[model samples]
Target: MSKSILFIELNPGMESTGAKALRICKNMGILTYVVTSDKSFYDSSLGNPLNDAEKVYEHRTDLYHIIDLVEYIKKLNTTHQFRAVTSLSELYVEQAAFISKALGIKNHNYEAIKLARSKYAWRDFLRNKGYAMPKFIFIKDINGLAYVPDEIGFPCVIKPVDGAASVAVSVCDNLNELNVAYEELINYPGFGRGITLNKLAIVEEYLEGDVYSAEYVVYKHESYCLGFTDRIISGYPYFAETGAGFPAKLLNEKKSKFYIESIINIMNFDNCILHIEFIEEKNGDIQIIDLNPRLCGALIAPMIYEATGIDPIKTLIEILIGDEPNLKRTKNRYCESRYVGAQCCGKLIEVKGFQQENLKVG
Candidate 1:
């Protein structure tokens, strides 16, 4: 029987990763399929995986409705059997876990994925494991603002319990700022249609340290830290990420391998790729900030591959199909990525500098 893999959603911005995965599966003679509401699935002009996939399934239902998505996949499976399930997006990681479970395919722990997706839950899990973490509280609504503890006092961070791409994440130094940030978050417009938003937010003590991400892959209970990346975020009260460079300077010194390994072992993450964010204090303390149970989004994957010839996206596809990935590095180089956001609300007037052959616009 021919094998097939189901991608829950080809997350926007990471279309290159999804397309590459589909192409790899096709080259291996395995069928490729995608289920997404993204209009790009039908418009090749915007770069669609449909060009590489055997079929494209459309579902407008919210990803939070796991049962509906699972049932939808089950119906699709009656015609096309899927051996494994995966997603390139963090927003649908939980849904992909449930669908994989429903299809009896190998996947990350569903409960673990749920906890990893929530900053509050993951912090609690790490605390329970005796790991040092920032003091935090869960806020359901504005009224819960009173519960923000004194110890987690001024200069704390506030972010949605379930969020991605640093959306709706902010830092407040006082009660007034906290209140204003809370109000703004509740009305944040980025939450997509049909998807249920987590009204709850995590208010935690802010840590003073340099930020970095440890990227790793877990297969059959064994974890391997591919490397680390130095995350450069916008200055001050806002924690918007600007760009990242790899391999992280600390990784070059080889001091972080033990800590990264310990974190993965304690978390017991399996059959998945993970991107863990942490703070490195000047005093040599490392505290985890976020644990993402999916491939590192943005250009991190390609950046890693450019630095070290091991392709994480391809390895993830291999794991999905029950194959051991060759994580060996065949080359070494330095890579970095930056995001260019519009400085003002205006139309494009002129372009410059991108005409160079060595530069890529997007």
Candidate 2:
């Protein structure tokens, strides 16, 4: 039997972390198989990342359904000896855990994955564990929206319990705004991949101050804090990330360490990368806001590598497949990943300016 890895659904479209990982696996002679819902997603011009994959399986069942995904993988398991099961997509991280468990592969802790993905559950878990977290209330039904002001208060954030890409994430200052945000959260659909949106939402007290994401690489029993990445958020009432800077500047050394250590010790993590998002208070205190038990994203890999001379994407793939990765920093510099948006969403007509001098496109 040949050794193989069963990759769960990958981040589609432009982000190429999934593509880069598959290429590395191919180069290292690790048989790779990607299971996705839509095969054409990886078949597009930008989807060449799948070219390096040994095979791509498009399952007929809904990718959002864990049991269905597990059953599909189990059938695939009989044909290929899978050494590991993983997902590069944050939305599918928890699902990958369940599939790995069903296949009896050593992976991240399932319960911990659940806690990390569910926003309300994670905040409560951290709070119970003595970590200072933002006040939050889970609204399973629209009727619960009325309690937002009394429970979490004004100047809060209303977001889906499990959401990404800042979809339906808004800062509400009053009951009127809160109601508007709530309706948007409810009307907003899921990933459109056949999975029904959870519809459950969370109204959380908006933590004040700057936000940063810290990546920790957990291999064996020790976790190496990769570095902190600062974020450039868009002008609000709404919270959508615009850009990120590596090695957060003006970081409160004591509070940052305190928060980072809290994350490492509090979560039930294993041999996987933990992408924890946190807010640094003006009073020099830190509060963890979001947690994703996986590598940050596609663009983050190159940014981190250029900034510190370490390839976290490769490191993530190696560790997930039960292999040791070289985690040596050979460069000391600053790298950033920027997200450019336009007035309207449409096809990429032309993107220029990379030809300019003094700009290292990573």
Candidate 3:
């Protein structure tokens, strides 16, 4: 009998990471049921980009939708008997954990998942572990705005505690600018809609340095530093990431070793895949920005495989499903996926060279 896997996601459909997962599962001889939140997920142009896969399911991106999917999956397990449940989407990580725990399957500890998902929680965890983190406070609201100095003064950053794709992250140089930034964030399209701003926001003393992300594979309580990559983020007041490239030509062996050791020790991570952000200041001090417990969505793993032949996604799944992840660096090929930024000009225009091979267009 073939083993089954349950996947939940909020993306339009199987983008690059999803496609990678699909390919790996097929090769491993495991049956996969790809679950999305809605039919619109498959309706968008990005929905069927791969156009190669034969089996995938689309549901709505909603709580009720996911709950129903879980129920259906549970029923199927009695008949099909799945081996594991996992997710690559940030929003569904905790949900996946809950499902796996309920099913008595292999998964990351729920506490580890929570810490990885929340920026504020992860910062506090690292700080408490004696890891160097920027001075920060979690604010419930603008109440007592005058007391900002008591925590951290001007030149601070305001970002949602649980946010990705660099959404609503702003750097404020002064008091008035901070207020304006907050307002802008509250008014962003997804705010108060997808997630509640009233929950909490983090105010932190901004550290100046070159930003980079360290990608690691933590299997059976051992952390393997596959590689680090330079994160390209737009400058303040808005810090949206544009892309990432692997083999982080910026870091030498010593610097890489220091970051890897620090992350492993501070996070106390066990048997998980992680993506962490760090700032290497001019004085050679390293400060952590945040970390995520899933595969970094910007195709960082594939880029690393392209550049250095180390695939983090494949390795992570193998760990989750009880298979040993291949930790070999196969080839030195630099892979990069650039998001073509477009404005609200109109409907559609001509896109050139997208059909070329070796390019994963989402």
Q: Best candidate, TM-score-wise? A: 2
Best by lDDT: 1
Worst 10-residue lDDT window for candidate 2 reads 41-50
* Clash pairs, model 3 backbone: 37-59, 37-60, 37-61, 38-59, 38-60, 306-333, 307-333
Per-candidate TM equals 0.92, 0.93, 0.85
- Residue 123's lDDT within candidate 3 is 81
In candidate 1, what are the lDDT values of residues 4-123, reduced to their tens digit?
A: 988876654325677678888888999988887654534554555566788887786465566777888999998888888877777787888878877877565777887788888888
Residue range with the least summed lDDT across 10 consecutive positions in model 3: 190-199
* 1-362: candidate 2 lDDT, tens digit per residue: 55688787677654567777887788878899988777665556654566567988887434356687788789989899789888787777788788888888875578788888888888888789787667888899889888887888889998888887678899989998888888888888667545445889988898788988888888876778878888889988887788999877644766677667656666768788888887887777777778888788746678898888988888987887677878989999997777777878788878678777555554
- Every model's Cα RMSD, please? 2.3, 2.1, 3.6
lDDT of candidate 3 over 21-77, digit per residue (tens): 767777878777755544344455445623433345554434435566577667767
Candidate 3: Cα lDDT at 211: 91
Steric collisions counted per model? 0, 0, 7
Looking at model 2, the pairs that clash are: none
True-structure lDDT of candidate 2: 0.79
Model 1: weakest 10-residue lDDT segment is 39-48
**Models ranked on TM-score:** 2, 1, 3
